[model samples]
Target: MKINKKIACFILSTALIFTPFLVNIHSYAETTSIDNEEDKREQEERERQEEQRRQKERDYYVAVEMYSDFPKLKNDTQNTLTVQIKNTGGSHLEKSKIKVSALPGEISLTGGSSTTQNIGTIYVGNQTSVNYEVQVSKDAKTGTYPITFEFTGNYGTSVENYKAYSYSKTFYLNITKTEKEKDKSQYKPFLIQNIKHPAIINKGDVADLTFSIKNPNDKPMSSIKVSVSPDEGIVNQTQGVFVENNFPANGEKTFNVKLFAQDKAEKKNYSIKLTVEPTNPTEQTDSKSSEDSNETPKILPTSTQYTGIFYNAPDKDEVDGVKNPQIIISSYSYGGTYVEPNQQFPLTMSFVNTSSQKVLRNIKISLSAEEGTFIAVNSSNSFYIDSMSPNSSVTKTINFVTKPDATTKTVAMTIDYTYEDTKGTALTAKDSISIPVMQKTLLSIDDVAQPQDVMEGEPVNISLNFYNLGKTKISNLKMVASGDFTVQGENSYFVGNLEPGKNDSFSISAMPNDPNKISGVIDFTYEKLDGSIETAQKKFNFTLNPISPMPDNNNMDDIQPPKHDNKIIYIGVGIAVVIIIGIILKKRHNKRKKSQELDLDE
Candidate 1:
């Protein structure tokens, strides 16, 4: 029984896990089907609504046509119009209203007081017509008048259809003037074509003006007076035209007028009144007629006036210890005459415009020193200026110091200025300044002692003497050598602002690879108290001694004697001595025997 219970529990747990997966799949499919059905219904509803809206528009729309029995009529005759409204829809159209409007100065309704009227409701595919009578004014001009009729209809009171359906029609009503009216004379329209000179003229410029007038009148007319009066400045100073003149009908004429500008006149534009008065004063004496004639004054046209350019030249003065003089220096030298070594001199550049127009602003000035010789200093790098007005000028200052060893130097400077004229046109001007620097003789290298001959693997020494011939201070004094040689040592000293008429000595060492063949140039550079650099060069040569050779040690055995020969000589000498002794002894024995006998005998 326990085993059966365990198997049943296992089956129940497995089913529980897979049941959720199956339920989820079925629910997803059902939801998709519902969504598709809803979308189809929504689309059908939208299409039905669109069709209903279009049918409503068709039912509300009304067509209108304008017809006139005599569209073209004489000014003395009466004109009539018949307006028709029709509905060509499948639904009934109701409460239609038609409005008729006549343009101004063309036609007027004869007896009818109202312009708009209501026509009864129109059934499907029905038409309605109404007759309107209008009279053309006798004095109406010969032109076409546009008459418009608007029709409004209602289809079912849906608020939407009431806003959409409206129609309109338009036609022209030509009205011709009577023969007697056309025969009457008409005044031609005239326009002033051009003016030769400006309304306002400068004091020295000419002020000539010319005007063209056209006459389009039908009949001939005479006795016309053209006059002009000066509102300011000199009045009619240059009399170019009389007060009275005559112009034939349908004829044109050009009149010229001139005026002079006085020197004392303030700069301003002058106004002149020109009129075409009647030469025959008896024609219209009433105040009303005279006022009407003067309404269209024949004023001479004019253009704009302008003044010339004017300005003053830059002044020559000193600003902040800097010379603001207008001096042009094409050539300059440092460390000479007017300039001292290690001293900074200030330079100024000036410019101006001598015209009436204001000088342009934002003028840029660039300053640069020539390479190698001149040393530029101070805030004179580059600057911008605001503006220089008429008769105004500006100046800029730059500071420069002279190098200690500088003999004679030249400084070149350029100036660029830009401005706009009275007409707002751009104008540019360029100028250049040259400054000459005086030659300075101070702390200069008088002479140098460079080695003419040096041995290989040995150091070469260079000796130099600097003389302070000028009145200035020299600092950071040192001697340097550069070339194919290695510097072994240098004599450096801070002379600290050398006083005038003082001298200093310095030396440097150089070791060459092949001193015997050492022949090259060396450079010496130093600094002055004013942060200027000085350079000098010298040529040197070196000589070297050759190394000696060593002795050899092979063949010493042949110089000594052998020991065996000495031993053989010694043995031979001993044998000879022994043989001599034996002979003497034998003789002595015989002699002894004999001597003994002789002694016995003696």
Candidate 2:
């Protein structure tokens, strides 16, 4: 009861959390109205985001949305069917081709069964439509019939990781009887590839043989079994395996089987019996069986093939049934981790023959790039090796220069080589290695505008200007200001992605406590193309004198009065007084003498 309650609670919580998102999506699709260009743009962006979120788990998917132009057709009338293809995958589909096939006679396509119309390219969340002139025979009934559509193409964001894929789906169409018109199909799928293998078996040896098994059906077939039985004196060491996935529709996969021969086995040719069958398969219809549900085993058609060609015993000296020799780039090195445009660097590579039982000779190696972005420096692109023993390796170094105008940031160099086996049979193989070519990141910082005499404990505005002057863009660009100061607002800013030849700037207000020079570093960091972190720093320094608070009138740090000499001041004052007294006495004496002379005269 507790478990059941917990499960119910969990379900309720999940529904509650997701209900709003569902409602928002529904409302946006059904109710939202685009009143202006901005609204339309926002709708497009939201749709793109929603689609990307929905396809997060799928790498690439191309689906078919088919419809017919003429729904109601009369006898001896012409009709057209329209095939629409949509790319809902994570990547772009290029060089796409769609082919339609149906049961012959009653209803026939204007183009023969071999016809395939080119749809070009379809971007993510985009659709491409093509019209096929479908014709129906006048004797056909008016019921619905199944028609299979096959799509094949390459998909990826870049050339290095592009992969080939094919999708086949069956859609029904209701077409009335009409006059017949047809053109023979010149389209042929690349199939029936019998990769030649040296299937020779010496006595007392185990041999592993490989074969390409293709699914000829329009739908995926599961539990495909390929059995190989050897003649007398030989043992089939191949064990049956449970396949986890179905054979891709209209595609092929390689399978391997091991065989062992007894020491006393006859040297004559032995007929090997081959059998193939599918346990359960997907069928095209209006309804489909649940792929994840248990399937009941049903009797299906099986093919039994016997090839009289048998394993041959090598001559008395040679060891047959040996695995093919493969040359691989075990380890490679260059002058630096990244190469710049028009820069010369030495590329050293070690080639190893990985086969244990085979020694390869006459190795002709040639290194070339698809775009010819790399050119050898004073050397040829091809090299020759006399021979290499089993499990042996040889290292060679070559100086090369990158093209000055190479557009790709990362270039793939292909190594095409051919070596001869012990029997002098020449085998050719191709290998590739990726090299990172980055344009020098030139982050130019406009002269940082310094603040006027800064005062401690006061906020000062500091701004920086920078530009990306390089040819490549940078990602996750972050700017940080750190020093002996307090930033008023955000000290760190994320610029996200910066495009080439783009300019940007940021500002921050910082308060310093130090009385001396206050210094701060504005560091800009971003991820390089090689996934390495690089940083460019701009240092800003200013003299910040402590701003004394308004004199507290009692604080000891305030200015004090100056001392004076009191003795000198006293002497000067006494002299001034004596001179005034002498002047007064002289005046009194002159007045007295004048009065006595006047009395004597009377």
Please, what are the lDDT tens digits per residue for candidate 1 over residues 1-602? Answer: 54345445644664575568546655765675566577668667866766666565554443434344434455667766677666776555677787875455667778864688888678876788877777878766544345787777676655554534566765545444443322122244333455455422334666666666554454333445556665555456555344423355567777876566655554333555555544554351212333557543232222122221111122244233322212112222333335554678766555553444444555555555444333568554667766656546666666767676654444555545555543445555554444555445355674556464443344555555667777545554444445666644332323334566886554455566564544555455656544578766665554545233222221111232322333344446545644765575556556656766777788
Tens-digit lDDT track for model 2 on 412-450?
999998999988998888877778787776678875576
154: Cα error in model 1, Å: 50
Question: On a 0 to 100 scale, what is the lDDT of residue 591 in model 1?
Answer: 64
RMSD in Å for model 1 = 52.3
Q: Number of clashing pairs, model 2?
A: 0
Give all candidates' CA lDDT scores. 0.53, 0.65
Best by TM-score, which number? 2
Residue 264 shift from truth in candidate 2, angstroms = 26
